[model samples]
Target: MNETHSPAFQREQLLAQDAATSNFNYEEFRMQLQNRISHLEKRARQLQKAMWISAGVLILCFPAVLVIEGFRLTEIPWVLPLWSGIGMLSLFLAAVFSGIYSSRYRPLLKRAQYDLQLSMITELQAQVAEINRKLAER
Candidate 1:
């Protein structure tokens, strides 16, 4: 006479519990993946912007150097070296940022957005097929 003692009732209870847990886990996992992808995208963008800014600095350096030399501003001992140092530093920063963005963050962001999602979907499909098979067996 007890519903709790019935197989149907027990199966329903287990299924309800599983659905609740799976839904929660899926949402949390999806949010985490989205956050990670967002962070990667932000970093990639920042690196790209920085590389462009450095390029701008390097570009402007030439004219500034020319102006300094034209105006005979290099008469001071430190003036030329200062501009040279700035130019060199900007060039180095641009190269480094470009390399990091192209080689590291950009590739990683692409993988995370596309390849990783595809792999996860494949895995989830396999898990679903297994679950269906088990249910059929039951």
Candidate 2:
């Protein structure tokens, strides 16, 4: 009589396998959430840096045009218009970047944070439940 082939033995093995797989899946999900948060944070930082650089260019363009005009550096009729166009373009880019950062990445980061916290709470609850189960068995 091979006890390993008994129905009870097979049932116990299946239950153990299911528990192991459940734990593995939860860990993988938690790691994926953390990775997403990290990527979003990096993207947000990069977008912020780009926005600041565009804003700096926008701020300098006015003084630059003023100085050029004051010094009478060039008689080209298109020079002033060119500088004004550059300024406007920089302003537009800065505004767009700011909007994207606020409306897109910021919200995603917040949501990811909430998801990570929820996963942590779930993992803790599972641990407590398992401990209680073991204590009851004893």
- The best candidate by TM-score is 1
What are the RMSDs of all candidates, in order? 8.8, 8.9
TM-score of each: 0.59, 0.56
CA shift at 115, candidate 2, in angstroms? 23
Worst ten-residue run, lDDT, model 1?
106-115
Candidate 2 per-residue lDDT, tens place, 61-102, comes to 978977887989658788878888989999999999989988
* Candidate 1 pairs with clashing backbones: none
Whole-model lDDT per candidate: 0.88, 0.87
Which residue runs does candidate 2 get wrong by more than 4 Å?
A: 1-24, 107-138
Native-structure RMSD, model 1: 8.8
